[model samples]
Target: MTAGPYPPSMIGLSDVPVSNLAPPTGALVALAVAQFAAISWLGRRCEPALATDRWRRFLDDGNAPLMTVYLWHLPAMVLLVGAGLLLPDLILPDAGLHWWLIRPLWLANCALILVVLTRLWHRFETVRLPALGTRTGPATALAGTGLAAASIWYLWQHGATLNGAGSAGRIAAVLALGCSLVLLACGQPRTRRDAPVRGPELNVHPVRSGPAA
Candidate 1:
């Protein structure tokens, strides 16, 4: 999982001295901004009906199924992989598969997990929680929760290998996930209410009859 330089020992649980962790250039920031713009554009184009949406409104109205799906997918993949490892050799004989084919198997497992989770999500409507209060507050809370959880998981799983690139990727992924949660929270649908009608008085005008007379 380690990519790029900085040594494998630099990763893992070490009280390494603090140093400059900045990327080589401002390219990373520019890339992040570009990504955000692209995502915003795609959101508008894809969800035209919800174009005028706010993140808080979306979260409050209980329409964040994808967030749940994304959150659960990783764990599901881990479980599936573990189960696959335990399966009888006859069924999924590991005939010295190449690394390229192994990657495909991993992706297939992840996809299967997502499909199963999606079905479960549909059945329970767990994604549709009532808007608890102000959209910003709840959305922030959810983002914080997701970030904290992701951070803990990253440290636990890849703490030893968290070099510059890994750290950057982890931070980017967590931020993206947090933003998605916020968007989902803000994009909840509003409930419809009946509006009262006002009564009006009628006025009549008489036409001139000079020609007839």
Candidate 2:
């Protein structure tokens, strides 16, 4: 539901009906405040549990690879859903039948492909400047940041149109952008000879004679 000139599509998951009826401003404000308060209470209650070792590790592990999932999940889902739509008889299960058997396999397939792609593209997210003091370092970082931002914007704008001719191009562009960002941030790999070396230390100890003068 939406207020003013906005459509129900734009509002996303509202209590208001799909009809043209507009809720009062006071009611909208009250609902929003109530929602916020509920969220705050939930967060406070969950904080301690979320901070425990198990939860902490789960969050860390999930977060480490979440960027890859976020980046590729849409395309993967689109491809899978498109296939199911194109050949429903061959790919998708009948309504309310065999879904339990097919769903797990479908989910696993998606997860496997995503994991492979994530591994392949992981370097970009882990990019680190070899030397921040170098002129190239700052420039590379800036360029990488800009490219990453552009890729995100492109995805956000064109995500719904994944079935179009431009979908492959969009995927390729994002992949290239991610790789280029890594190259810029990481620079050239350092050789073994270039690694810092520590020289051996010399020690001197005074010797005492049998009978000191």
Candidate 3:
């Protein structure tokens, strides 16, 4: 990481053209292969820890809000960096020894912001909305899913706000995405165990509730 092409000496990759990123050759290819091998070896060594309760819970909690973490990390960094611009006198250059010294401070700030963002939206990760289990529901869900995917693709390619123009397209995309979510929440399938039993003759189960009937 310290080997980056930073300031006073070289142009950063972000400033370079896409064509400049040539495919890996020779030593680079060997390095990539070695990384893969190392990862496989580490995974094998870590596998046994999964059986332990501590590791299991750690993995479970970390994974449950992973998408939230992934989505907000870059945004959090952007927010912090943008705020830093307000303190022009105190801010350091994008590279150099002084800038490198503050790297840990930047990472700490980003981590705090990410934690708050994750707390704000983590409930959505485990949300369970009731959905119809009928054939019609499945069809509607599929249609909505397709529409949502198309809208996301368009938005991703053209930016979410669209340079503050094409209000109609933006509105349509937002509406389509919202409708797709509704369709998904109200039309997704349910398994047999999720269905309620009906027209039963008797409550024969000894542990049945309802006034000890």
Best candidate, TM-score-wise?
3
Q: Which residue segments of model 3 deviate by more than 4 Å?
A: 1-38, 92-94, 123-127, 130-138, 188-213
The per-prediction tally of clashing pairs is: 15, 0, 0
Pick by lDDT: 1 or 3, better one: 3
**Per-residue lDDT tens digits of candidate 1, residues 86-165?**
76462245566554566677687788888788777756766457674333456666766676677566655554343675
Q: Write the per-residue lDDT of candidate 3 for residues 67-109, one digit (tens) a residue.
A: 9899888889898989889975456465678788888987899
**Candidate 3: C-alpha lDDT:** 0.72
The candidate that wins on lDDT is 3
TM-score of 1: 0.36
Residue 7 in model 2: lDDT:
41
Instruction: Please write out the lDDT profile of model 2 over residues 1-213, one tens digit for every residue.
Output: 445644444232335343232333454566679999999999999998898899999989889988778998767767788878987875686766677678888898788777877888877877863572223456677777777777777765555344667888688667867766675657545657767898998797998778756
Give stretches of model 1 more than 4 Å off: 1-31, 40-64, 87-97, 125-213
RMSD of each: 12.5, 9.6, 8.4
Residue 107 in candidate 3, Cα distance off native in Å: 1.1
| TM-score of candidate 3 against the unseen true structure | 0.62
Looking at model 2, which ten-residue stretch has the lowest summed lDDT? Answer: 10-19
lDDT of 1 at 130: 62
